[model samples]
Each structure stands twice: as structure tokens, then as C-alpha cells.
Target: MEQTNQIERKLKLMHVVAIGLAYMSPMAVFDTFGIASDISSGHVPAAYIVVFVAILFTALSYGKLVRQFPSAGSVYTYTRNVINPYLGVIVGWVTFIAYIALPMINALLADIYLSAGFPEVPGWLWVVGLIAIITFLNIFGVKIAASVNMLLVIFQALVGVIFAYLTIRSIVKGPESFIPIGDIFPSGGEVPELFGAAALLALSFIGFDAITTLSEDTINPKKTIPKAILLVAGIGGVFFFTVTYFMQSLFPDVSIFKDIEGASPEIAVIIGGNLFLSFFLSGALFSVFASGLAAQLSASRLLYAMGRDGVLPKRFFGYLHPKFNSPVANILLIGVLSTSAIFLSLEAATSLINVGAFTAFSFVNLCVIISFFKHKGPRSFGFTVSSLLFPLIGLAFVVYLWISLDIFSIIAGLIWALLGTIYLAFTTNFFKKEPPQIAFDELEA
Candidate 1:
């Protein structure tokens, strides 16, 4: 690839963090609060804590690997370089499921919001329109995408703060009192349910790792990318916990929400009334836009990485626009895939995401462990704990979350993995040859 046609390095730490938060969609705590609360039996905060703690370990593992292998392929690059080339191809292929499905999920959410607001307007129009706008922004350049997401993320944070304030005020004024701290914590027997809820909420934490996919686009990725990952996870975790604590405190009774999955708007109305509802809805739509933009951006980068390495058709997937220096073809392809959102439901799209998420998360941690053994490091306690113990804990949490997935997602993920294996075998001539590898030395130069 020519230098002029390559992805440009322009992102700073703030840009990376903004994109990560946008991808996570800070308002998501409101959107998933009802369902997660129901699953956790009104202990939404507890579930957030569970997921956040698990993700912290994984984030550390991601940080550890990105410093060594800071490429756009993320876990794919780490696993492939640390482990076997074939396994790396498989991990990359499976992780593609989450990357591709996330934009579709955002499209679905935008359609739902727009359709609810404009009953006379067609829903498909909203989905198509939103996808087109985001696709254009991403194709223009990653810097533009990151900038737009930064603005939208700011709006989302403002809404979260206002919603929290209103919810706190509402709780103080209402006849019902806040639940005791002890009641907010789950019992030993309820640990399974808590984990189940945490599994679902894992969808909200996708952004932290997604930031690693911008390794090539980020300035000083070895330092900036790793710090951004921790910042994203920490900021997202604190925001989610704070917002949900008030929300769970405000509405202990889930019965008030007529539709559990789509309860945030209702909660918005109760706390802030029609005016705040309008504000909340607007923010939610913007959140969807922000998320879709970042999701498509990350997905395109991953495809570019795979394509440049010949895992996919390099001519189509690896090609970057000479002027924009963006993966134009990959961005367009994801835009087309997002059109499937018009035919799919939110639950189905969400179900596809976690399968890939857990797979990538598990492998990233494994990469850290594998890399630790493959290389020689000091035998000090701190290095040993970080390199070995942390990843092991992260891997353990991933296993629990994987087991907590519903039967449908589990089966679907298995089928997806099998398909990837078949494709890998075909590409490698039934394991007779080694899989193609990304030239990090060339990329670094």
C-alpha cells in the first residue's frame, strides 16, 4: 500500500477517549437499565459493578497487549502474533461478527426513536438516512468521525447528569423511600442472576476495546491507546454506576415500566416530564448516531487490517481513498450491511454482538497470558500478578459471561465460529499453508 493511501495518524488521547465513550453510548445505562434491573431483580448497580470489575481486568490485558502489538486488528493482531496464525485468523473472523452487527443495532435504535417521534414518517427512511449520514462521515476521515462523536458524547453526558438530578429529586419528593444499601446488594443464591444480567450489560462496555482498533489512526498508540482504554472503561464504569444507582433507587418497582426493554423514555417522562422527555429522546437519537459512527469506523479499520493481510479480498477491503485516507470500500460495505437493520429486530442484532464480544475478550486475555510465557520478563511479584493473575481473572469472568448467554446466542455463535473455521481452512488450503500475517514492521515505518 502507498503511504498516501494509508490510514492517517491524527487522533490524540482525547479523540480516542471521545470515540470510545461515543461507541459505548453513555446514555445506554438508561436504555438498558430497566431490562438489566429486571434481570438482576432491581439490583442494576450490582450488575454494573460486576461487569465493570470484570472489564477492568480485561482492559488491563488489552492495555498490556496494545503496547506490544498496537495494530488496528486489536485482539486479532495480538492473538495471531502471540499464538498461532490460524487461531489469529479465527479470532479475527469471529470478532467481525460484533463489529458488523453493532452498526445495525444502532440503526435499529435510531429507527425506533424516529418512528416513535414521527408516526406519519416511514421508519425505513430513518434507518437509511441515519446509516447514510454516518457512512459519509466515516468515509470522509476518522478525525471527522471522532469530532462528531465528541460533540454527541458531550450531549449524552449532559443528559445523563440532568436525568440523574431529576431522578434524585423525584425520589426525595415521592412517598416511596430509597432501598437500603444492603437490599441493593444481591444474596449468594442470586449470584447466577446477577451474572446473567452482567452478561447482557456487557454490550455497553464494547467501546473500551473498540478503541484499540484505532491503533494505526492514533498518534503514539503504544502510550495513547492503552491510557485511553483505561480512561474509557473507568469513565464509563463510574458514569454507569452513578446513573443506575439513582435510577434503581428511584424505580425499585419495575412494573411501572409498561415495556421493560423500551423503558428509558418512560423513565425520562416520569423524572423530567414532557420537556425532559423531548430532551431525552433527542439525546438518545444523537447517542445512536454517535454509536453508529464509531462502530462503523472501528469495523472498517478491522476489515482493512484483515484485508491488508490477505484474510479478505485486499483489493476491496484494504483499499483506502487517496484523498481522504479512509477505508472507503469497507465503510460502504458496512453501510450496506446496516440496511439489514430495517428487517431485523433490536434483540436479534444485540444477540449477535455479545457472541463476538466475549470471544474477542476471552482471546485478548489469553493473548496476554500466552505472550507472558512466550517472552522473558522479570520474575517479580508485580509483573507476575499483572501478566498472569490479571489475565486469568479476566478470562474466568469471560467464561462465566459466555455460559450466561442465552441458548439462541450460544448456538448462533457456534455456527458463526464454524463458518469462520471453514473459511480459514479454505484460505489456508486445509492447514497445508500458514495463514497470512499483517506486516507490523511495515505499518510502523
Candidate 2:
């Protein structure tokens, strides 16, 4: 295989950020706000604030790794290069689960929302249709995927702006005062409860790291990917904080929501009538589609990276389309897996995905610590703090969230890890040596 046969370099800073935001899906605040509000006792924004800071720390570490390695493997590449290849393989599998599960989650969400609007159509049909569309877009090329994501992200942001505007109007005209700033703090819940809520809220920020998986396909990845990572997280955090602040003001009581998942849509009706509700649903659908598309895109690249390294089968997973310069096989594989969403409940799907995401977060933080120690030299205190101290804090936060995950998620995650370990032992000839190594000198050139 040659470098020209691999993914083409076409993404810029804007395209990378657009894909990251699409993966984060600004409309996701609407999907999870009611649950977070209930958990935090009307302090949903407060929980988001906590998660935003925690994710920022981890995002900084991601910036360092992407700049150093500049490969599509993400945490897998970072861990393999800095820590150990076996651990990297494990991280790759865990990351695979996380990335693959996200698109399924989005597909399931789309199915749920579309099913409500069109009862005559089957939910499975919607899920399958979305999976097919996202797969096609991704297989076409990274540029097409980025372009589609840009349009979807713009529409979602516009919807959020309208939502914030209406929320402010309701606050000003209604009996309530506009300065309900107290609602954004954790007044009703204790620290443990607040932490739990923040952990759940952190799930909404998982997609920002998806940008790093495009290192191989990004121009000036060392510079562009890092800035895009921070921008995505920062912009997303502001969007989440502002939207949830207004939502908390409009619907202060969590008890009022008849359906937690549907709460935002219901609020849209109350504030802007049926017309706004229709627009809101449309925005939600587009956001979910964009998220799924980005998820599949990143997941396929991860698989392609592993395949190129001989960790996975090369003939299929590693193959790049000659014309499109995309991982067509891996894209179709994700599409096939996404159809399983129709058989799963949203709760079950999210729980499994959260497990993989938190596991990857914890290890990425650990990878930073390892990298810092491995490449020690005379450097400023600023370098030490950015690479070591911040990652340590992020490690603690993600470990806490990992321990706090539901029992089912913990059990399933452990099982997945166990399976990976068994496969590694067999592949490495009973732990006698490394599994395999792929020379990246040519790819890097």
C-alpha cells in the first residue's frame, strides 16, 4: 500500500470544527436537558459547566498528542507510541466501541423523533434510511462529508439562536424576572449528586475529540487540529451554557415535563406555537443526522488506521476507494452495525456508548502523563502543567465518572476489555512479544 492510496488531505480548520460540532450536535442540549435538570434539581446548566471544564482539560491533552503523532489512530496511536502497543490495541478496541456506538445512538434518536411525527412509517425504516444516507455521504469523500456537516451545523446553530431568543422573550414578558442567574448553580443537590449529573452531561461533549481522528486527512493537522479541538469544545460549552440557562428560566420545574426526551419540543410549542415546534423537530432531525454522519466518518478512519497497522484485517477494513479516497468498507461496516439500533432502547445504547467514551477519556489522559515522562527534558513550567497537571486532573474526573457509571455499563465494558485481552494474547503468541507494528514513515511523508 502507498500513501496516495490512503485518505486524502482535504480538511481545513473550518471543516474540522464543523465536523466536531456536528458530532457534538448543539441540539443535543435539547435531548438531554430535561434529564440533567431532573438529576441536578433544575441546575442543568451548572452540570454542563462542570463537564465543560473537565472536558477542556482532556481536550488540551488531545491537542498535544495530535500535534506529536498526526495520525488517524487518535488515542490508539498516541498510546501505542508513548505507552505500550498492547495497551494501544485495547484502547483502539474501546475507542472503536465508543465511536461506533455514537452513530447508533444518533440513529436511534432520529428514529424516535421521526416516529413521533410520522406514525405510519416504521422506526426501523428511519434508522436504516439514516444509516444508509450517512454511509453514502462518508464513502463519497471527506470533503463531501465535511460540506454536508457544515450545512447541518449551520441549521442547528440557527435553531439554537431562535430558541434562545424565544426563551428570553418569554422571560421578559412573563411574570418571572430576566435575572434568574441563581438557577444555573447547584443549590438543590449535594456534591455527589452534582457530580453524577455532570458525568451524564459530559456525555454530550464526547464528540470534540473526533476531530483528531482526521489528522491524516487534515492540512496542517499539527496546527489546525489542536485549534479546532479547543474551538469545538469552547464554542460547544458556550452554546450549552447559554441555551440551558434560558431553558432553566423558561421551564424551571422539571416536574412539568410529560416526556423528558420530548421536553424541548413541548417547550418550543409553548413559546413559539406549532410552527416553531415543527422547525424545532426539523432541526433536531438534521442535528442527529449530522452527528451520525460524523460518527461514522471518524469510526471508519479509526478502523482504517488499525487495519493499515495489521491490527485488523487489511484487505477490507484498510481498503480505500480508488475514486473517492475513502474507507468504503469500514463505512459500510458501520452502516450495518447502525441497523442494530432499531432493536435497542435508547437507554441501553447510551449506557454502552458512555462506558467506551469514558474509558477512552481516562486512558487519553494517562497517555499524556506517559508521553510527558517519556520525553522529559529541560522545559518551562508551562509545558509541565499543560502536559502533566491538567491531564492528571482530567484522569481523576473521567475515572470518577467511569466508577459512577451504571452497573450494566460497567459489566459490559469489562467484558469488552476481557475479550480484547484474550484476542491480544492469542495474536501476540501468549504475550511473548508485541502484536504487530506498521511503519508510518511513508504515511507521514
Candidate 3:
């Protein structure tokens, strides 16, 4: 019988980190390995190292901004408060589309994998069933969703561990010695290939930033959220580099795989035969489940933040269930939206993701630089590097990745941005007024 407008703060640091890891999907290293190895000329881990640097600097920017204005809006909240309110709405709108698209990608992947395994079952059935289970858990409670993600993430780590054991054992039993140091670094004329692989690998780190959207649901968000962001990025990076380092050492080239595009399944067969391949594929399916759960949770929290700020409809988007104290309305809306996966191609859904992700990454870094100059902090070496230099480097790195995107992604992103601009114009009466600001202090209180 009790109703509340606020989302409850119940998640601790570990829970938040778990959801973030699920969102990143550590098993993804296998999915990306074949192509990245080919591009890096047999140095996937080095490419991971290249992308991790960019991710580390950006994680620092996220940490700095979350300390100043910790809210469920993530990059959207940061931009609105630190930069301009109107700009924040546009950023939020663009990122909203991005978050919404993520669940669809997971759903599509699930459908493909499941349908491949169960030939008689329809693909659309898999998509709908996957979304339904994820939405049910999310609406049950954020804590429940986080717990599920933790278990799923643990399972993924187990699979990675087993795979690594088999790979290392195989290499030891073979003729080639483990070239630990040499293979991870590129030789002359391979820098371009390494960067190219890094650009592709950058998308894998999207979930670390998504953790910021859980601020309202997190205890001591200003401290917990920032630390959780760094932990998620750092942990995921280490897991990725460790897995690929061994894989690169074992194969040393993409020519070994039958199908480079779908090499992970084959790699499992080669390493441990059919028995381990089943476990690997099951791990991949569970990963899709984990990712969809976290994605919907983040997307709903974002909508709730914007709704509370009057950037979207207040009644529906901002509403929390009286019993569960979760964002029921927004969660269901995303659940409904996820059904679009049945109609969308995986490539199309995948392309839409990078545009929104890169935009948020680039802007969050820029927001840090803007905040540094706007709010005069103590003139010290630590503050200068943390506030300005780190973000500048992060910005440059994101710009490089942004330009590396293919022409289709660029055009799709522009079209999405244009739609957001049109909606913003209508909301603000053609730029006569600024968008409403979120009451961060009151929310924390």
C-alpha cells in the first residue's frame, strides 16, 4: 500500500561491479578474438592493452564526475550539470537510444545461438523468451537482478579459467614454447593494425560506464560508484588480456580457424573437443542472459532519471513500483522494445550501439576537461593531471575510435542524433527555454 517516487539505494559496491561486468560480458573476448588477431597480426592481447589505456583514462573521468554529481543519469547527468542542461538532454536522448539498443543486441545473439542449437524452435520464440525472463528479474528488484548477474559472471569466469587451462596445457604439450613477452607487442609497420584492432575492441568496454546509471540504487554512490567504475574496467581488462594472451600464444595466427568470423566455437573444439565446446556455448548463452538483464536495468534507470528531471514523461518513466521500489514502467517499456530484436538483424543492431557508446565516452571525457576549468580546484600536479590532462588524452583516444567507425554506423548515428534534436526542439519550444535540471542534492537526501 506504500508508494514512493524514489528508487531505493540497496546495492553495494560488489553488486554494482557484478552488474557492470555482466554488461561487459567477459566471455566476449572469445567472440572478438579471431578478427582482432587477424587485424593485430597475431597480437590480440596487445590490442586489448591499447584499448585498456583509453578505457583507464575515461574511467578516471567517470570517477571524477561521479564524485561531483552522482546520479542515475550517468553521462547524461554529468553533461547536464557540468556543461549545459540543453546539451545534456541531447546527450541523454542519444545515449538512451544506445542503452535501449544494447538489450536488443543481446536478444538477437541469444536467438541466433539458441536457434542454431534447437533447429526446430523458431528464432522469434527465443528472442521473446529471453527478454521475458530478463524483464521479470529486473522488475522483481534491482538486488535480485544484481545477484543473478553475479552468478552468471562467475560462471563465465569459470568457463574462461577452464578454457585457459586447456589452452596452456595444449601449448605445453606442443612444439612451440610460450612466447609471453614478444607476442604481446607489435613489431615495425604493425602499429596501424594494432590501432585498428584496438578500435574494434573498444566497444567491448561499454558496460563500465553503464555502471554509473545505478547511482541512485547504490549506497554511498559518490564513492561506491566511482570505485566500482574503475574496478569494472580494470577487472574486465585484466580478464580479457589474460585470456587472449594465451589464445594468441597457442594459435599465433587466424589461419587455424575454419571460420574466422565464428572462431570461438571452433577454438573450443580444437582445445578440448566436443565436451568442452558444449560448456563454452552454454557459457556464451548465459552471458547473453546476464548482459540482457544488466542492459535493461541500466536503460530503465536512465529513463527514470530523465523522467524525474522532466526531460521525459514524469508519471510513467519516473514511477517506481510501490511494493518492489523498482522502475517498473520503464523496465516494461524496454522489455517491449526488446521484442524489436525479432525483426532486427544482428549487424544493424550492433552498428547502432557503437555510435551511442562512442558519443558518451567522448563527451564524458570532454565534460571532465570542461568541469576542471569551470570549477577552479587547487592548482596542484595531482588535480591538474586528474582534471585536465587525463581527460584530454581520453578525448583524443575516443576521437580516433570514432573516426575509425564505418560509414554506415556514422550515417545511422547522425540520423539518430537528428531525431533527438527534433524532439528537443519540440520540448524546449525551439530553444527558448533550457531543459530541467535533476535535483542531485535532494535525491541524495
- What would you estimate as the lDDT of candidate 1? 0.89
Candidate 3, residues 128-214: lDDT per residue as tens digits? 999999999999999999999999999999999999999999899987567668656888799999999999999889899999999
Q: After superposing candidate 2 on the true structure, give the runs of residues whose Cα lies further than 4 Å from its correct spot.
A: 1-5, 180-183, 187-189
Clashes per candidate, residues 3 or more apart or on different chains: 0, 0, 0
The reply for model 3, stretches above 4 Å from the true place, is: 1-3
Clashing residue pairs, backbone N/CA/C < 3 A, model 1 = none
lDDT at 190, model 1:
90
Top candidate, metric lDDT: 3
- For residues 53-150, write the lDDT of model 1, one tens digit per residue: 99999999999988888789998898888988889988888898898899999988888888887989998999999999999999899999999999
The estimated TM-scores of all candidates read 0.96, 0.96, 0.98
Please estimate how well model 3 matches the true structure, expressed as its whole-model Cα lDDT.
0.90
> What TM-score does structure 1 among the candidates reach?
0.96
TM-score of 2: 0.96
Number of the candidate with higher lDDT, 1 or 2: 1
